[model samples]
Target: MKTVLFPVLISSALVLTACGGDDSPSKAPAPEVISQPTVAVKVAAAEPVSALERGEQIYKRCKACHTVNEGGRNRVGPNLWDIVGRDAAAVEDFAYSQAMEESGVVWTEENLSTYLLKPSAFVPGGRMAFAGLRDEYDRDAVIAYLKAQSPAAQ
Candidate 1:
């Protein structure tokens, strides 16, 4: 009895639902015209960073192992206070590998770039532990930063 009554109620609901909305082809609702709001945004041209500035920013990677300020203490790597013109593996308290000590490397801009490219390859067995910069511009910039940190620059 309950099933029969439910079917009758459902059929009536279906008939009423079918008769409700305007389904005429001529009276179909017009396609919605959605207009997105236009927002005006002003973009400023990016200021170009100087080579030294860029190098300084990049030097953050080395900060864990090195210090660039004058008389700064050494970490895993030596304090690079006057590294631009200094000998490799010359830091007093820092331990350097035999390969680096005997490599006879003088830290010129070009030499620094090469070493920074691949420290392990540059001085085989030297313990830099850095996976080289690989980018020439980045090497140049970091060298510029080192030069700026030197006493001669001041």
Candidate 2:
């Protein structure tokens, strides 16, 4: 009985030793690699037109109050013929406000745009009844036209 019991115990101990213990380390799977599609992009360029061309289109609204040719007479407002470099309120026959005469503002592109945008804002006491052009593109075109009308640009 002891001989049989000893052999059975030895076999069980050998089987347990062959099986690895829980202390052994485990391994993880390798990471996967993915690829993305490439895209192409393009940009457009900006093209600016001459001031006269823009101004001519803008002056359609101004035709009711002003004229821009030789022998052109004053209508509701004084004739704007060759008025780019001219002094403000300098028209001889037409009456001008004292504020306009005293304002001492030069009719440059900057000044014209500001005055055309808002006359009362530019000169609080100004008599020009027409509200200014709200669109910036229209303003630029009108200024370009006025600049073109000037002898200097030609």
Candidate 3:
């Protein structure tokens, strides 16, 4: 019996030794992560609006008081037909301020630019209640619009 038990115990010990190491399951290695290169991006600039188109939009302010068409009736202000080259206060039957009537000036583009910048400063005691345009682009746009609307331009 002692001889048989000793052989059985030796065989069990050998079997346990063969199954050694950690009890947890074996795991595969994780995949390596690759980084991408950075890139530079450029944005395109927007197209600029034409002066005539911009002026037409700005002139909506004037539409309340004046008309730029031929034979268009005057409103709070006089009709502006041929206004770019016409004399100051030249609209017939439309009453003008004493300062404007006596200004004795032609409606040159430069003169118009100055006047539209500050109506009161251009002609003290004038009756135009419009606050002048501060932006040079706005003044230029409206001038282009008025010039384009003229019969002479056609």
Candidate 4:
């Protein structure tokens, strides 16, 4: 019993010493980090489109009704050639609402801006079917586009 017990005790101690020692396997070394160049990136700023160009895009919707070319005939809406600075509802053959014709408003940029924002609001009981350009930028663009076509622009 002593011989067997001695060997068993020795074996247990050896196992414990091996496993519990500070000589355990180490973790893998961290990868070497290299410094990179500090690059100063040049960011190009976006340039705004010319008002006339932007207005041209906005005018695509208005093309269905208004024409900006000189001598152009009225369609669903009146011919808009030289409309800027012209009197409102002054297209000769085109029928204008009493409300608009009697509004006594000129087609100045300021008036046009207000009118384009909400046509009906600008002239109550007017016959224009457009809901109006809601965006201030869009209204400006349309005005710019109209100005570009008008003799006043040149």
* Winner of 1 and 2 under lDDT: 1
CA displacement after TM-score superposition, residue 60 of candidate 3 (Å): 0.4
Instruction: State the C-alpha lDDT per candidate.
Output: 0.91, 0.81, 0.91, 0.88
The parts of candidate 2 lying over 4 Å away from their true place are 1-51
Report the poorest 10 consecutive residues by lDDT, candidate 3.
Answer: 21-30
TM-score ranking of the models: 1, 3, 4, 2
Superposing every Cα of model 2 onto the true structure, what RMSD results? 13.2
Q: After superposition, how far is residue 48 of candidate 1 from its true place, in Å?
A: 1.1
lDDT per residue, candidate 4, 42-89, as tens digits?
999989798788999989998898888989999988999999889988
**Can you give the TM-score per candidate against the true fold?**
0.72, 0.63, 0.71, 0.68
Supply the TM-score for candidate 4.
Answer: 0.68
- Sorted on lDDT, best first, the list reads 1, 3, 4, 2
Error of 3 at 136 (Å): 1.0
Model 4 poorest ten-residue lDDT run: 19-28
**Residue 59 of model 4: what lDDT?**
93
User: Tens digits of per-residue lDDT for model 1 on 1-154?
Assistant: 9999999999999987766656665554678999999999999989999999999999999999999898899888899998988998888888889999999999998899999999999999899899999999999999999999987899
Q: Candidate 2 or 4, higher lDDT?
A: 4
Clashes of 4: 0
